[model samples]
Target chain A: MIRAALTLFLALATVSPLWSQSDLKKLSDSEITAFDSKLKSRSQATETLIADFRQEKSMEMLKNKMVSKGVFKYKREDKIAFLYSQPMVYHMIINGQKLRILSNGKNQIIDLKNNPVMREVRTLIAASFLGNLSQVGTTYKISYFDNKGGVVVVVVPQSRQLSSVITRITIYFKGSNAEIERLKIEEGSGSVTEYIFTNQRINTDLTDEDFRIN
Target chain B: MRISGLISSILLVVSLAGCSPLLKEGIWLQNTPFAAGNVPYVYDTIPSTQIFDFTLVFKKSEVTGIVIIKTAGAGERRIVMTSVFGMTFLDFELKGENIKINYCIEQLNREKVILLLKKDFEILFKPDHSKITKYLYSSPDRLDALEQGNGITKTLMKFTNYNNKWPETIQIEHPYLRLSLLLKKTEYDPESI
Candidate 1:
């Protein structure tokens, strides 16, 4: 009897992790609607956000993942500053239709009016940081997954232009607060880039000069 | 007869000028081995794998991104370049004398461009020592230049400032295509994280 019990205990221990890993369940229609509204309300109430982010890019061919650490700041209306500090220094700031990039001591201000790629990037930034997936409802097919306490929102591009670049984008939001804890982008090239945000401060004081072109 | 002789002389001068090699034997040399530098052609040390912050400019358009070169196996390397905004421009696999484009964005999907890119990376990753016909060294800068050809166009590749056996920077230039690639190595300290 003791031997049977020991066998059962070993089996449960081995199988428990797999079960926990796959515990993320697909949310029903009503649950998704409620979650979407909560996200929208939280995003609307957020005036400013500042967070330190760690980015990991894993390619199929690479044995070692490329790791980078940076900080991102977002302001209401339209302003973002994404800065990388390690390995190399790269700063990308966006204000309305203007995109300013600083790298290798060179700075360039590119107008995003006719540039489809940059415009799409701007749209993505706004969707992930400023608004919820429901706000980008027209551009993507959105689905929700309940991962234990947190939620995972997966968005696939509805447009051919965007689909050619990315296969899907998965955003993980923490419980109750509708705060984005991570954003994972899967490319058509079989590589994945994941950004994990920490030390998030919402409604923080940020200035336009923070995202200035000059 | 005098005028014809003068024309013949002018034609001969022009032909000699045209036949002269684009890469001068010693004009690019700083030290000599009688004729010029007899330094043995040395290829850059094969690094484990490297990630570079690159800015690629062609014509008036400029793109800044990250480039990762991962050695897949023996004599094989995989190179991936992606934009800062998270769009992949290219994913290429280079095996011995073979190149495969796993993925490329539409903007850079042209035949001529792809051919040039393959040639560029080929020169970058594996400089053909067998095709090298001349070697020159600039002693002042401690740089080594190798002239490689395929019976038609010549390519000049230079490696300099090597730490141990690893080159700090590599420059590859193709005169005919007017294409150049400058690769600067970045130190990866896994323990720093």
Candidate 2:
């Protein structure tokens, strides 16, 4: 039961960036493709990325917003790790199909080959950071919106299965960096989890041992 | 002949069901007044909503997350457990004896697991003292144990009072399922709201 719940939560992973919703307009098809290409090229150029992240989770029913801080690391191809410092010490590393989670000084590694939900989560996390936005077009209906800050990429799940749990995922990029400055995931139950990234160092030297799991 | 055998077995089991309790060799207390302040998070006398850093260890796997428990009213409570990554694992609503599963992950959708969790939380919040057939007082622990049982299963719940009225820690143990839950009250931050 614990394993099931853990995997399901991991599948709905990632969070928000704060931006105004008032001064936004939907982009045309041509604009969407151009932005997608720009993001794709930017990701291809990035070899490694390291950032400090602050996650804020808000629910309409909850009295307080849940705040947590962590460090995020992503290497070329498909190596990603999130090490949380505040609240508690938790480390999660996703290297290819293997996912290693360390919580409370205990470690457990899970293979994502058998679980379709986890596979989709891997894809979503990768696309959110490393780009390849158009590759997941079949699973998510991509829409582009222009705002004063930069661009907001609205991704809605096409499948009824995923849509039932997660309503939408909005990725925010500021200025011309094309990096994900913020991400917000809206649940069907009126819960929103947002992540804000800062102090990003792109194309830095990150070794394979950084994402290793024993 | 088969029907007679089944009836005999049932009668024997029923007769010997309450003969032994899970908690053994302790003084049974009588006329111990049960108050609202005795149990943790039962009523809204002090702050209805509570957030805790929860950790569950089962077999070889261990999962840690944040659990937010809110008391809507007397018998109505909402429990939501979210991962450290901000994804929700379980969302449950309890109204009296009936429990509504607002949302549960597919992995934990088993009837046995769900029933166990429902019973666990119910025992934590409401704690039907009327159903408790015996109250065991252990001199070593300096705590009174509430033993509630029926023909099939038995459960024991113990509360440790940190303050003058309310308990700061609650421990629930189910011998049959080998399940134990430890709930501790965490410091509330007003600024986080």
Candidate 3:
């Protein structure tokens, strides 16, 4: 009897958890509406998002997983700053009209209108987080998939210009409030960056200094 | 006719002088273009995370990113620089003598800019030993190589603080192109996390 129990335990241990994860099924119209409504209502209550995030980057060039850890702050309307603390301190922020990058103690302000590529990227990140995937013009072909636990929305860029850099973006949503669990960005040049959120506190009050560009 | 013959002879002598074979003859070997001052490091091909204060001089703009170099793997040498936002600025591979660009953003993807980038990496990674006609050691830590051409391109490399056969710092000066790269070392291990 002990031997049988031991065999069963080993079988459970050996079985991969991947099978248990969501298998991304087509959501019905009602399901999509429900998700949209849930996102809209929750985003209303949640004015600020403060989360400790882990970013995993894999490329053809990287022999090992290029892992980077950082903190992310997001405010409604349009304000987000991703500050990478591990390995070094570098900040990428989008506050108001300027797109700012702080690296190696030097700050640079780039106009968003002149650069279409970064403009699209900024759109991609913002729209994905808010769950309003269709807000970023008509350049992307968006699709929605849902599992028992969460929903995965895949956004594929159709434009020749945007497609050169970003191939697709997958946003995974979980929890009843439709919290953004993970975001995966695949580049056309054979690289993937996955941002996983942890310790995500909703409705946290963040000041303007928190999202300062400089 | 005699004066013309004298001029031709002088020209011939000058051309022959330009082709002097002994300029780069001493201890000539493959892959030692400027001839490294000492043995180079045998770093793990996995590539440690290297962050340099990157600057595109003519553009007069500077941004920083982690410069990743994967030398030990198969195919060409892969170099990737990404911002803190996880945005990739430059991604390319060096295969033999040619560089195959996988992707470069629109900002740095101009024809002339791409050509300069190709030349810059070539200068940084590959020594211009083919054009090198002279090599002199200014100091134990400094080595200067002179390339013979209409305009001799001088490459000055200083490796002062080296431990474990690795250069702690590397500086490259391209006279024609007002470009300089300063790479500083840092501890980058992805597996630890």
Candidate 4:
């Protein structure tokens, strides 16, 4: 009887780690669902979001040379403007039907109806700008972490196609509120873009006419 | 006889005037063929070693930045390009006919640029015999005609209309940014010491 009890205790000890792992997984799933619920609720409450963004892009030339920097602006409902101030002066605006690029007093308009790449980029930016966090689950495997201030959501792309370009994206919020503090996107090619939001004014009087490509 | 001689002189002057502009235009286009040899070198033999500097300007939307490229290659061909601010962007190797573009920014749609550059480089150095023959034969006849003019030379041809040479100055007239690049101060080191 003593030998049998000792054998049973050893078997239980060996199985404990597996049980703990399953429990941890269950906890992670619950956290992810809760995080999704929080984002969905916040997005539903907000009407619109607008912010100023700075973008830096690096290009490799010939061997191992890199040069990068740029700035842009983002508004709610797929309105974006980019201005490159270095090397040259160029401006681009993506409105509803057209993508307009103005440089050297010349305007070139590309109809976005047939441009697949532009459509994809626009969709990605619009989804993020509108705070459609639930749609993010379609493309990414999301994990959530709760800290003192708010929630930190790390989104890793699920599809191989998405993962080939973007490795992960991290978004930070203030408390359980839907207000986002920052977003960082890391690419598989060892590039990162971080956007910090400040002085955010939600639902201020903004007209659709403001997005005209002038 | 005097009337006939005077008419002949006037006709000669008019003909000369007409021919002068045509000759000048011919010389202009000959001196600057829009696109010429792919790489900087003239011969088909790939050098054992090479070093050069390049400046690239990109205009997207309303933003513009200058990128400087410095390259040094040895053995099979290893290239290291850096920006003017000393940021290493791309490092790759080219062994014989194979090219490997090691690093590129993911956000930028630059795959086409890389493939084009690789093809151009291949054409520039160690050109295939058939392609070279086709290029020599099928090149624009206007360029061929311009080559006959006295102003253009094999060593150096200056363009009066556009202030740059082949493989040095690239003109990109985009809707967003019209860029003119001057590839200045080039040196070629051929010996592999």
Candidate 5:
């Protein structure tokens, strides 16, 4: 479950920056293609994405926000790692379709193919990295909204398996080349997990060993 | 002859069924009188919510996750546990005398697991013993949640690692089931409602 959630969350968080336009005004077909191309080109230009993330999780039950700090590394093509440093130490590696977690000094490896939900997440991550926003329609009933902060993309799961666990995912993006500033995941109950990214740096040097499993 | 044989086998099965541990171990009772002075118990912090770094110990293995407990819209309370990967293990709720389990993983859906969890969560969530039975307090600084049946299962859920007006941890254990939960690093927050 942790593998699936972290994978989906990170995939969505990373992909949120791939939408080009934040405006709501109706655009010509040419304008839409041009906008999509701009985001696609910018995303492809980068070899890696390295960012320091401050994740503040607000649950319906707790009054104080659950805050943690971590480093996020996404090497182009197919490898990503998220290492948590505060409150606790955890390392998660996603190489190809395999997910590995090192926690409690024990390492757990899971195959995305064997776990359907995780496979969906794997597909989502790949689509996001490939800048295929249109493919999301295959799994989710998506709607776009215009907000003061930016454009909000609300995705409701179309697949029965995914819907049983997660209700919806809402991402807030801003600017002409929309940068995903925040994302909120709503679960089966009324609980919500909101993630906000900060100090994002793109096209950095990240090595293969960083994504190795035990 | 066939009918008689079938009846005898059925009788033997029923007779042996009564010897099962769950039926023979005695039913769990929830009327423990335990209290803390001015400390924020689960129900005391009413309409409030908290998140804990949750760890569960099975007989053969252990799993770590986060548990979120919040009061539902009604007078009800809900507890949700998820794997670090975000997959949910269970979603349980207590509303009046009715305890509703919205969902739980198949492996944890055993009769023994549910029964013990029901009792442990009751002590953790509804901890107002002002009118219930009383506890044999061990210390001035420590508070405990007590369950009595066969000799008294006085595990740490019975004891609170407490701070001034705050509880740092609630450790619950079912010795027979080899199930234990260490709910640690509690952060007292404002009202979630």
Candidate 6:
């Protein structure tokens, strides 16, 4: 009886190791599925965000030793405008396919097809504003955590060119609504651009006249 | 033949008579050369913050340029500047050595602008021996004739007068644009600020 008991005990111990390994594998697979589901849910949640955002940008250049301030406006996926009020007067407006840049009271209209970088930047901003969080993941490795006021999303670029210019981008989401409170872009060359958003309104009526290039 | 020879002789005598006054005076017949010695030298140890509007114009063929600086002080320096046009270019505040320049427009060649501005400032304030040599060699007689209290303007004016080359008139020749500038006026007063 003692010999039989010893053989059974040894067999059980060997089988137990295999059982635990398979159990861990199953747990990992389920965890991955849950994570994917969570990502999909978050992406879906962001799809309903359509609004006008006001951004105040601060630009710093090391050689120039100046801190520049500018205002940025974005409406949905189509229109955007950047205005610099100090040192010089400069304005750029992009409404759909048409882009107009006014410098020193002279206006220049540039085709959007040839300017891929501007298009990409505009798309990135649009995507973020529309809550296409998954698209951001395609361009950036994103990590999120809760902060004192809201959620903080940190994005690190996946592309070499983007990574070269921008080291990291931090987005602060206000409240539970995921409205961007602030966006900070830090460059590899020690230049930084900080944008603070205020007085954001979603689905408000913005006319086509408001986006006129002039 | 004798009559023609007599006519020629009379003409030569008339010409010699006209030239006699210049020979007696032993000076150029046009005018006495204006001396630059009468101008007064004015120096001010201005706070870097006092400079408001700054412009730099380079020679067309050469890399050298003259920098024009203007300032407004209402307790502190608030500088406003533009390029050739009244197009506002850079705005900055200076506290001691710390200078802040904010660009009004973003250009593709921003690095070039920054570099040119840096070089301009260095030429303006820094005591560079090589620059002094270059300035002197460009107008050797001007420096030689530079009298005390004449300052840079008198030296420049004399150089322009003698060489017919205005070193202060800067020209910038580039592939895209050619720029020429003449320094119209300059005013500096530390006590007023």
lDDT of 2 by residue, A94-165 (tens): 899998888767788878775455566668878866677767868898877886748898889888767766
Question: What does DockQ give for each predicted structure?
Answer: 0.39, 0.28, 0.33, 0.08, 0.13, 0.03
Give TM-scores for every candidate, taking all chains together and pairing residue i with residue i.
0.79, 0.78, 0.75, 0.48, 0.65, 0.45
Per-residue lDDT, model 4, residue A38, is 67
Instruction: Give each model's whole-structure lDDT.
Output: 0.72, 0.73, 0.66, 0.47, 0.62, 0.44
Identify the runs in model 3 with alpha carbons over 4 angstroms from their true place: A1-23, A129-131, B1-55, B73-76, B126-161, B190-193
CA shift of B164, model 6, Å: 31
**Clash count, predicted structure 6:** 5
- What is the alpha-carbon lDDT for the whole of candidate 2? 0.73
Q: Compose the digit string of candidate 4's lDDT tens values, residues B42-159.
A: 2213333333344444453222223233233422455544332222345556666677766554444377556444443333333321221211211332111111211111111111
Model 4 sits at an interface RMSD, in angstroms, of 9.3
Q: Please, what are the lDDT tens digits per residue for candidate 3 over residues A45-70?
A: 77788899888888665556667788
lDDT string for model 2 (B1-193, tens) is 9999999999988877746666674333344333323432332334367776666655445566777888777778888887777777788898888899888766667888788778878766655434454555433323455667654456677767545545666667665556666565555453466
State the lDDT at A110 in candidate 3: 80
Ranked by TM-score, top first: 1, 2, 3, 5, 4, 6
- Judged by lDDT relative to the true structure, which candidate is superior, 1 or 3? 1
**Most TM-score-accurate candidate:** 1
Q: Write the per-residue lDDT of candidate 4 for residues A18-89, one digit (tens) a residue.
A: 775344322267765766676666666555555544433333233322222244455666776555454345
Q: Taking the candidates one at a time, how many backbone clashes does each contain?
A: 1, 7, 1, 24, 12, 5
What is the descending DockQ order?
1, 3, 2, 5, 4, 6
Output the TM-score of candidate 1.
Answer: 0.79
How far residue B9's Cα lies from its native spot in candidate 1, in Å, is 20
Clashing pairs for predicted structure model 1, backbone only: B33-B36
For model 4, the docking class works out as incorrect
The chain A TM-scores for the candidates, taken one by one, are 0.84, 0.84, 0.84, 0.59, 0.77, 0.62
Model 1, A101-206: lDDT tens digits are: 9977889888988566667656766776665567765888887899877789888888887688788888899977888899889888888889889999988778
- In model 3 chain A, the worst 10-residue window by lDDT is A15-24
What value does the lDDT take at residue A66 in candidate 3?
Answer: 68
- lDDT accuracy of residue A115 in candidate 4: 48
The pairs that clash in candidate 2 are A15-A183, A15-A184, A15-A195, A16-A183, A16-A184, A16-A194, A16-A195
In candidate 3, how many Å is residue A214 off? Answer: 4.9
